[model samples]
Target: MASMSDHELYPIGDAARRSGLSVSAVRFYADAGLIEPTRLNEAGHRMYDIQAIARLELVRTLRELDTDLAEIRRLLDGGTTLHDLLTTHLGIVERQERTLRARRAVLRTLIKQGGTTAQADLMHKLVSMTDEERERTIDDFWTEVGANLDVPDGFVDRLRAMRPVLPADPTAAQLEAWIELADLVSDPAFRGAVRTYLRDTYAAPEARTLATEPFQEFMHGSGAALMEELLAAHRAGESPLSGRVQRTVTLFLEAVTALSGTPLTAEARDRMADGYRQIPGILRQLDEEDAAAGGPGYGDTHGRYLALVAAINGTTGQEHDPIPYVWIADAMQAVQPA
Candidate 1:
């Protein structure tokens, strides 16, 4: 064979220069099976054909598109099975393009308005809470609770009923509610309150005691009825300071004692008597004060109290029903210093 110049059959380093790639890069591509040298020289150094140099250029182009090395190898190996990979890459590119377009739209709006830092901050917040992101946040909270508690029967249904579902177009109040609710659930104090409530219901020996069953039934049934009656009186313009109010209160207390398995012991009755003595003086004071001079009417005040109670109790009458009394108590306790 005739002796050829270095240009005719260059070594790996020269091939790299011709291909506009580093020698190390050429070796990596060869090792990755994207390209191979045509022959080896006397010292067993790689000798590349011109065609191999062309293949290196092609590999560099594919890599610039972010194609994986394994996929590159398949393309080089005559694998015509790259349709799925190309489709996936195209979808990703399309999504990125969409995001950029949205960002540009926001910037344009800001520019036209002579944007402030507040607008920029609002944009950041909104972008952070994509629909998918919000759903994942809610799902994560439930998932964590699911791992810890056997969700009581009807609890999930109640949650679905009471939970605020922010509209596709949410108002500022709704957004504020969501932020507060999220914060409440994430707080250790709130969690501790929830744990305590759950423990009281499910773990306490007293809760299972026969004496407690009657009390529970009374609270859920008769006590609820008494509350309804008192509410009705307030609604009817009856003075809560009147003798009628005292009579109703006495009857309600009697009902409680009757419903409880153990009647009020002598000591308890004595304590109750002491409390009763103080009530008449309070009622007299309330009588002397004008109804219009106080805060909201009794009915309105009671309604607000009931709403808070309902939220704490997790009771739901309608979608996004008011908070229960128990929840209000728990939340209040959580916020109180030990």
Candidate 2:
């Protein structure tokens, strides 16, 4: 209090220069009670000490960050801590960042897909759906497929359970996958084709039945692992008739029959081999037909749907060589011990 000579103050112009704010902005903040003059000069003009200049700088910074005037006012009034304000603001920034990424993904996909009005409208609709709505869309697809069918219990649930999950921060591929998958399931033609396939195949009265849970579990679990093993063997130039490949195929067949509650009989072997033999022709027919020329082939739609699911789920291993499978089919059909 006795060191009056140590006190220094500058006028409004100097305060604005020091704080990097326009004089009007400084004055506006002052009027808004965000910052005020440390004292009045002898001429009754506003003057600021060093502390007031620092406070003015803080106000300028907050305004630059898009903090509302009232929020800045609260901060200046000591209603909240700077730490808390910044923490909450950081979260807001992160959410905005995610939103921007998603928008970027959509825009890129739109460009890649030719950007027609129809495509744009589809993107808008897909992006506009809430997570629950998207989930409901998938549920509706599975429900309609299994409706009035004699499929096993949890059959519809099994179909619905492969829901594509879009991450919080999605890649461009994932967003594109979601767009395609959602559009596919929403299509009445696709739904009808898949439903017909299900009705004719699994829902048929004489269809061989497998327990839904065990079959799915084994397929996705051990069956997947075994396929990987077979793929590795194939890559290593092992013949389908090689000891390793044959042994792995044998174990796989045994496991499948066990899961289905059936014995791996010679007749079962013939049926399975016949089934594999038919795949290439079926795939070729589906591939040859133009999807736009007629209703979608059940197999083609299912494959495309799975490819999109793989993209969305960020999984791999879709590639295969039919040659190895053909050899395997021959091995299965050959005269062998049961």
Candidate 3:
């Protein structure tokens, strides 16, 4: 604790040299209000005491570490401690590293996609969306695709289950699948196809609510029988239109009619076949995209939705493996009267 009068002061040039900073750099920091001098020399030159020398050294070190000027100013003003600033800086650095890693992942996806600039741009957007924003994308999709349609019981819950929640640190493959899924849902043709399928599946709001119970009943009863007959036919090497196949197809169509509470006319059955056909195609497309991106295939949304609906209707054991819907539809078509 030297007396005020005994404390030595150095001019800016000497201070800069002692701190290993250039004179211009010292002037810049002083002018930026980052460093304050103890007094001005008679000629109006800046003069700093020992405390200022220590502060200037710290300022220079912080600048070397690329700390923001405002942050440094706060630190010097005693508004924040060095530990606080460093902790915040570490968070910023980590976020920057995450962004760089995401960019690298996007580059790899672009290369795998054959360097398509449009796809690269799309992938970049996918990676950049915040979690809330990504969730909104799914909401928007369901809104557009399910518009004015008769959604089954717990439809929203099923949609939520199918939602893609991208990980905070997504891999290249995950990003790629995200981009593809975003593209698929954004397509007008895709939306229209899903809309028509949904409309045909549940023709009215009343039917939508009633669909789960009868559907579960059919699935548990006649649906199981049809599947057994089909499997038996497959094992016997019989064509889908063979007498045995036609019998089971008739039984299946009758079961569908009973569930619908409507006449099982030719046109109605055609619509049913077409509706079932749409889902497997969509599922196949997602599966192909996931495979190309090296992702585990899209989680089984089609089956899961069905299972959820059955569960809500108090149906269990519906998880038993059964004949593919497409195979059933094809057999139904094959057995249709000329």
lDDT of 1 by residue, 247-312 (tens): 554555566556644454544444444544555565456444525454333223223323433443
Clashing pairs in 2: none
TM-score of each: 0.32, 0.70, 0.40
> Compared to the true structure, candidate 2 yields what TM-score?
0.70
lDDT (C-alpha) at residue 291 in model 1: 58
What are the lDDT figures for the candidates, one per model?
Answer: 0.55, 0.76, 0.70
Model 2 bad stretches (over 4 Å): 1-14, 39-50, 94-130, 149-154, 166-180, 197-217, 236-247, 257-278, 289-293, 298-300, 310-324, 327-338
Best by TM-score: 2
Once all C-alphas are superposed, what RMSD does model 2 give against the true structure?
5.3
Clashes in model 1: which pairs? 308-324, 309-324, 309-325, 310-323, 310-324, 310-325, 311-323, 311-324, 312-324, 312-327
- lDDT-sorted candidate list, best first: 2, 3, 1
Model 1, stretches more than 4 Å misplaced? 1-8, 81-88, 111-338
Predicted candidate 3 versus true structure: per-residue lDDT over 61-105, tens digit per residue: 888778989889999999999999989878888788788877887
